[model samples]
Target: MSKKEKSTSVNKKTLGRILKYIKRYSFLVVLSLICAAISVVLTLYAPIITGHMVDKIVGKGAVDFGALKTLAIRFVIVVAVTAVCQWIMNILNNKVTYHVVNDVRTSAYKKLEQLPLSYVDSHTHGDIVSRVIADVDQFSDGLLMGFTQLFTGVMTIVGTLCFMLSINAVITVAVVVITPVSLFVAAFIAKKTYHMFRKQAEIKGEMTSLVNEMVENQKVVTAFSMEENVNGSFNEVNKRLNKAGLDATFFSSITNPCTRFVNSLVYTGVGIIGAVMAIKGRISVGQLTSFLSYANQYTKPFNEISGVVTELQNALASAARVFELIDEEPEIAEPADAYVIEKADGQVDLSHVDFSYNKDVELIKNLNLKVEPGKRVAIVGPTGCGKSTVINLLMRFYDVDAGAISVDDHDIRQVTRESLRDNYGMVLQETWLKTGTIKENIAYGRPDATDEEIIEAAKQSHAHSFIKRLPEGYDTMISEDGGGLSQGQKQLLCITRVMLDLPPMLILDEATSSIDTRTEIRIQRAFAKMMKGRTSFVVAHRLSTIKESDIILVMKDGHIIEQGNHESLLAQKGFYYTLYNSQFAH
Candidate 1:
């Protein structure tokens, strides 16, 4: 990680969110603080009693066995009580920390659901996972340690100061004089390292993204014999992470030792000053001994705090990344009065529609088309000729920059998105099958589908035969994105999903591209039966597939240059004719 890699600084808003989570467990937090105070006070008793025993031995001629026995019992009781309170505080701290992390993690996941597809398209899956998992854990760990230290540290510092003041005010003042030097050292180092820690967290996310990409695409990498290339890319990212990690660790590591060195100076000064006061008869030897103990206890907390500050900076950076994700802008909001489409007749019209992923580069410009209910429309175009863009617009995955798309005279933007989308069944070239049983994957489009319906749909789409051969049949588990299944098999499963849905409108974008020619012919027959009395749009590479369509659109450079049935386009000897001729030119 370098300055070139974007880093998110911890702002006041992110800090306020952490505080809000803490306030949710306010009662428990208060209980924790109370316990810490009692523990710290009890801890001070041992040193105080030790000072008394010293006085009993030195100030008197003979040793007092009864007094020593009483001091020993008091010490034991103080240690036991302190241990119990600490145990309780640990329990309370863990409860508060994990609950806060759970809330943050859930919010991040929920935010992903609310976000548009564009956001997911724009981010790496592994980075998103790291934000929700690793980042939140780091934030939780820091908050837990910070809270635990803060309460007891403050109590210990204050208690030690009071005890020392009571013993000898002059020695106490000398100890206080050297305190700011140690604090300054910690503060100075912390300020310079905030950016370094932020970079480290960012690089960690990137490294995770690289690792996930390599793992997920390993088959592709191996097929291309690009394992060495993939390793090279990973090594680049890993090396950056190493450099960033080293820098972050170096800065944070120095903080503790440097603060401790400052603390040692303070300790040495207090020890020397207290001994001088004891010899001058201004303070007793026993008083000097207790003051030294109090001084050591006070300085130790300050040292621990310097380390906590560094840990917190790193955690804050991780938290800011999580908050940034949660704060992402969602898709355009639907109106409260938007129309709802319970069912669609599949009458779709795109009038003067314009859209572009990039404003300067026009992808879809002034596109106009209309189709009647229960009609078939086929779109034939070269790659990047706005074929997928049209599908995206129809699905409202990316809303048009201008004009409107309407289904049955109901403008899509004017209706609730869920109701509008529920009207259409879609199967794309890229199939997505989550980890689940085959039955569950088929039922994804229509969760309430009966077992009989699922099996029937699978058979209709030619997926049932292959599924029956698998172990456990319909109960066979599918890996992420249907890992074990071939491309053709995955396509069959997707087609089965669409078949089960039985929507009034269907969009098949290269739906049969992955299937073998024979299988494609078979599925096309199934599709023809399924397409009857349904408004269907087919985007196919095979000219044979669209020969009998109601309409064939030949598109180029984001515009439909020719529109007619297959025979008419070939008769004209135009762009579609040349495209059709080239496929079977041999």
Candidate 2:
């Protein structure tokens, strides 16, 4: 099938899955239906009572006081009952919608967690955030208002049609003639509105992303004095969003007014026809009056049906976006029969591994390496020479396109991703600390770790001193993303957090790049102590950091060109020797 056809099929499947998400709330749906039925019954009686009043007055040529009183009392009762039912329905609908929204949000987040790292790398954070916030909120409206409006509209239309036909089939036919025309108008507008709404949602997501970028990179913008440029770009996106929103609003806005106009015309025609029939002595004055009331009542339900048509279209548009996200296939997933590795000695071996982030460009090709248990292997390469890619593959962030990676005699792919990753502790180039106390950050790696264990881990990573210097030490709260801490401080806290877990294998991808040389030396010392008797892979540009490693590998163009001990490789005067000379010679 063509790509567009494939996408259409996928979207359909996604919608089906979303509908299934509502299955758990069947009870709430039933309750809503009950409430809507009650409201419809009450509303349907309004025209009947008016007809009764008209008939009584015309038949007796005077008001029937007792009968009028009874009709009035019944009308009041219906109105009060409907009011109560509507209030209860609103409460129940909100409660159910909230629960469904919570489930959707939670499920989306869980999918994010389970998704492989490549999916995250390929997708923008802003797009994902939009799905989580805006898209999900849109579904909330669909769940609460969409279902209720649709149900009530259908009921009102059916009920009104029954009563109208009962009054006079000729008048009913005249009023009902407008049904197909109104539907056509509504459907045409809804289709146009759907396109506009989808465009609006897309632009809104883009705007959100731009705002996120500006906020996250405020420092860079200030440093480069690019506020004007950023603002111009932002305004451009904002204008597009405004235009799309206006288009959608225009389409939705015309629906109700047009429907009302058509209904008015139909009602006027009904009155004229009823008058002619009454004057010809074909119908009583009472019947003519009753028909007029029913005709007016018919218009109200059609108007409601038109409104529901617009809302349902909007809901479908929103659902399409939401399903788009939930249907996205993760780039990496565990095998069906994957085994769990409870314990690992961390003997990492990469044999003839070839990998690429994209087609036609190989990031790592025919790379072979081995690190014995408890050995420290330092990987050194120039910028963009697949240094980080190695770490990514080692952590199973992205599966290798060819060859195999084995840890302790078990191929990484043969085991469940969680079990395979459980043996490793990683401190990334970018340090990210969540909003919490220093102790909490340390305990993040091992939630079950005791307070004493946390403090010891902090001390081992040389983070305890500065942490204690803070106002509340371990109890001091950190901002989201560790906004309160300096780069070095954040790095130290992240290192401490990783150390607390004491994973069997460790990957430090430029772990100390943010610290000053002196601080780097101190952190290196702490890292060395932690690295003892543990398998570790260190990716660093600094020559000083890797001097004490058991083995050093020089990589270029995704291939391991040189490998040996620091002293031996320095003596060879090859790639490693040239790299060391260049850095130290400067």
Candidate 3:
């Protein structure tokens, strides 16, 4: 009904979800709770033993040394057992906390694989990474604190209450009456801090995204003299983060001291009430001393629990973020009887297709195309003309809004995505290589390729020379995205992957855009060899590269205005002619 009510509902839901994950390892959790209870019971017994030893001393040298010696031994044994049980509880807590964190982190990462491309396209990579790594790590800390402290704190409070009631009911009632003060303070602070902590987590993600973007493109930022501008943007984000973090911390920190203050009040009241009882001769000095010790033990948990509450709030905020990612709608499920293209015929047809990333903005409408087997079809279009969208559609990365796309006369949607993609070898302008040796990258598509085969493919793509020049040659370790290599070199490595195993169809979307003219010429020769007798779709901006294609489709504003071979299009002296001459114009 209200904002606070809604937040409380969300926190309850998030905490419920976390408990479900913890339930998967319920055995360890139960064991940990048992250890905490035992430890608390042992800890509570020590105060009674202390009070007994004190009462045993009637006067100087009139002491019952034997009884005192027995009490001392019992106290020592209680302390040692409490320590051992506490240690065991802590170990079990760590085990459960880290195991649950690992499971959640693994699930988040696996979710990325099933998520639709649109989801990733809409969100920054850094933010997604933050949810998986940084947010999960924060959740781990909170869960660990909750496990180690919350259970023991509750057990201690209950154990001390029972022990104190056994000694003196009047003083126990006084201590119990003041207990709600600490709980009320803890609850009030927790409610106040929940939203602030959530806001802080969001800002932290934004800060992480900005830093990742800057670090990844630091060279570009410096080359364009954007250091000052980037710094200004970063400072803006940093300032907001600082304010949110300080506000969240300031509120959560209040819980500890406020609860401690209430605890002191409870202890003082217990002492005063017990002293009155002792003077009235209703209880011995020993019993009063024991009641005072129980009062401290009972109130100590409130202080520890208040701190746990602070951490639990922070943890719930981060857990909500991680669950948000996990809850995203994944890609459209495949048909139960999805066809598998064992060997594709390479005949792709798009009929009456209509699609757009945003519904209001019409990018591709009533688009129709047909490519026969072994045809070299090139799509040449200006920027923002839906050149790449076609590639994405063909690969089924994005489904069509209207009409259908078919491979070999079978609807693309009818076939399994893995099988459809397996039939085509793709090389895009934007290259991607994981952290590994150059040899490993080249053989990514065909990991079982032998050394000789890898070298042959590398030589065909003209990457062999660079590979040999590296300090470790083919075995040289490269960072993620091929960090140690140039852009051209990275593209070459990608091309080499396709060369290593040429499929039935190929999609070369500006495959050679990064290579130098000299290297481009050599790579084109390799592509020409690779494209022989294979259905190929080439998307390019450099018009000269596609002139030799069997059919050139010139697109403008998502419409194919002209379609024919380069020679026929030029002879028409139409839009394609204007585009062709402009590229070769003096």
Candidate 4:
């Protein structure tokens, strides 16, 4: 998990999961292997025929044109067939690689939907994207080369060994004995670099995460004039990535040469011994020539395998990360008898709720509150007072550690999450708008909304006034998160989204904080009309907005220190009085 240390050893369990995907296209895999097998056979046959040609020419002590012509034709046919098979195998390998990677990406995306909010909170957005996109891509490329070489190399080694044994067993034994040396060298280097590759992958994910965070928050970076600082931070991450990449490549690069060196030693041993055997008359000159060629062929596969080994190691590391994502625990299972609500009457209740993101650091504890149907409730406190945490609990973004939250007297945990969320509307200070036309953004929550309903909702949040003035009006394209719109305009569009939902309950967290006072008053009047007969929980800092609330819950350290209407709490001169005084009395 550290910068240098990594779990690079092939995780058999995770590898097993990765291999399970091969079953989805078993026929293609088998066909690829078959193509490799046939290609190896036809290709190896040429060397044998050449050896025969040598014997026939030497036996008569003259060239035989008739036999030579026939041999040449046979050679041409074999070459064509072998080439075609190799091409077919290459095509199939790519087919399998891409299809499998597609499934991997799809599976990761679907898993994202089922994963808990806490899971997303614990991971970086760029890291998630890296595994789902970049890592999977590497995995596919590596696997493509891996499978292509694996089947061919294995068949070539096996077929060449068999031929060598038949021609001259003594030289074949030399090759067989020396083959293990190459294997040992490859294994050792793979072990040494496995950690490097795994560490490199981890660093890549970190770099991706850092870059994504900086890019997404460019506004904040520029506003703070931290350009130099951001560049320095990026350089730091990039330097680490460079070192890891260099280390991994340096080790893997040596493997090919090491295997080739070992193969050269095997080739020398075969040549020397086969010549001696030929001089002893135990094997003919043709046989000796064939044996040497066979020995070279035998060692060639192992030499080729050095590259394959490194590729597989990298693929395994990528597979481990992808498997890690796929294996993550999804959301907790819904109860067998969980509440399934058909409708809610806007009654919201919470009692004796204890919770904390971390066990040792309690945030919200022993909390209790009740809001009657159609009432407007407001929560206010200084920052870090758990106002947003309260809203998170109500939305079941995080479950309470203890006690219950109910909607219409039904425990929220028992209800299906879809039904629970579908019944409430929310408009937060941080407006979220996607890249689309102006109308699409306002109707995001209710995709099936008609033009009349969308316009009505936009009018309610006072978004229509500005929207209509645009060059294309409702059809005007907005970039991601409403790029052209001001913060206040974006917020109104978000509030309009909620209005279109028309849910039984509403939660507004600093909904009008970004709007100018004049616009704020208009939106507040619109909100007052919307909350006429629906429960609403408003987390606000501006005191004037919530002055007529049916209940004002002043929170501190996650508890309601004071709860009453605007006037009664002010009459008591409790926390609300000081909170109100600090703003207006200034």
Per-candidate clashes, comma-separated: 0, 0, 0, 2
Question: What are the Cα lDDT values of the candidates?
Answer: 0.88, 0.82, 0.91, 0.87
**What value of lDDT does candidate 4 attain over all alpha carbons?**
0.87
Cα lDDT for residue 481, model 4?
Answer: 60
TM-score, ranked from best to worst: 3, 1, 4, 2
**Best candidate, lDDT-wise?**
3
Q: Candidate 4 lDDT, tens digit per residue, 56-119? A: 6885558787998898898899999999999999999999988888998899899988888888
Ranking by lDDT: 3, 1, 4, 2
Query: Which residue segments of model 1 deviate by more than 4 Å?
Result: 1-9, 59-61
- Candidate 3 per-residue lDDT, tens place, 1-586, comes to 8998899899999999999999999999999998898899999999899888888984677688899999999999999998998999899999999999999999999999999999999998888988999899999999999999999888888899899888878888888898998899999999999899899889889989999999989999999999999999999999999999999999988888888888889889988877887889898888888888888889888888898899899999999999999999999999999999998989999999999999999998888899999999999978999999999999999999999999999999999999999999999999989899998988898899999999999999999999999999999999886877899999999999999999999999999999999999998899899999999999998898998899998887878888999899989999888877888899
lDDT of 2 by residue, 418-491 (tens): 88778999998898888888888888868899988888888888888888999998999998678678988999
Q: What is the TM-score of each candidate against the true structure?
A: 0.95, 0.94, 0.98, 0.95
What lDDT score goes with residue 103 in model 4? 92
> Which pairs of residues collide in model 3?
none
Superposition TM-score, candidate 2 onto the true structure: 0.94
Best by TM-score: 3
What TM value does model 1 have?
0.95
